[model samples]
Target: MADTTGPISTLPGAHHSVPAGVMCDDHPDRPATHRVQGETDSFGCELIDMCDECHGEWKAYRDTPQGGVCDWCGKHADKLRPRRDYEEGMYGRVYDVCVPCITRANQEAEEELERSGWYD
Candidate 1:
């Protein structure tokens, strides 16, 4: 007979399966399966691996005006819309922006294009 009731025997490996704990910064009682990394007023923009429940909570917070804040200017309101804008040279990389910031960026892009004679 072998002594199997040991820490080494219970270690996560080919013979043993260890369950990963909840990695969500907000919810610690659920299993984390989604990775959220971006700028947030409440969370201060960082990489957070969260569970589905926490992710939903985050989305709700991001979509609501009172819960969501502008990532660019740190402005908080209930009317600010969430915008996903792509960055230059960052393929498929989209980040959150406020309505005002997106509007400003669009205006700037239009002005730049006009100045470059790209529209003409």
Candidate 2:
């Protein structure tokens, strides 16, 4: 079993939250970090933000009718289905990629961390 003691974790871990919008799949040595939707096994499936990666490695959400970040390259996600489902007062889900803007962003972050010697 996983640790579950937070107020949010009061509910089932699988149904707690799933943030919406941009997310990072993360780079090696540095865990993933992004505001992303959840993984799914079917279309219009519910997604949630996983913390294993600060973001997290996508749980091999393969063949899911719902598309997400490229399992490779982590780029070009326009092919992903847009978020069109919303329930009042319900938690939201997010997709990892939607633009090529992350390369620069990641690079900048890496440099900043490197300068600070936090690249270990």
- Please provide, for model 1 over 1-120, each residue's C-alpha lDDT reduced to its tens digit, 9 standing for 90 to 100: 111221111111112222365355666665566655443332223345666786678788766554467676787644654343434322222344567788898998799899999999
The positional error of residue 86 in candidate 1, measured at the CA in angstroms, is 11
Winner by TM-score: 1
lDDT per model vs. reference = 0.51, 0.38
Error of 2 at 90 (Å): 19
RMSD per model, one decimal? 13.5, 15.6
Tell me the tens digit of each residue's lDDT in model 2 across 52-92: 65433344442344445753346556454422122211223
lDDT of 2 at 46: 32
Candidates in order, TM-scores: namely: 0.44, 0.25
Q: What is the number of backbone collisions in each predicted candidate, taken in the order shown?
A: 2, 7
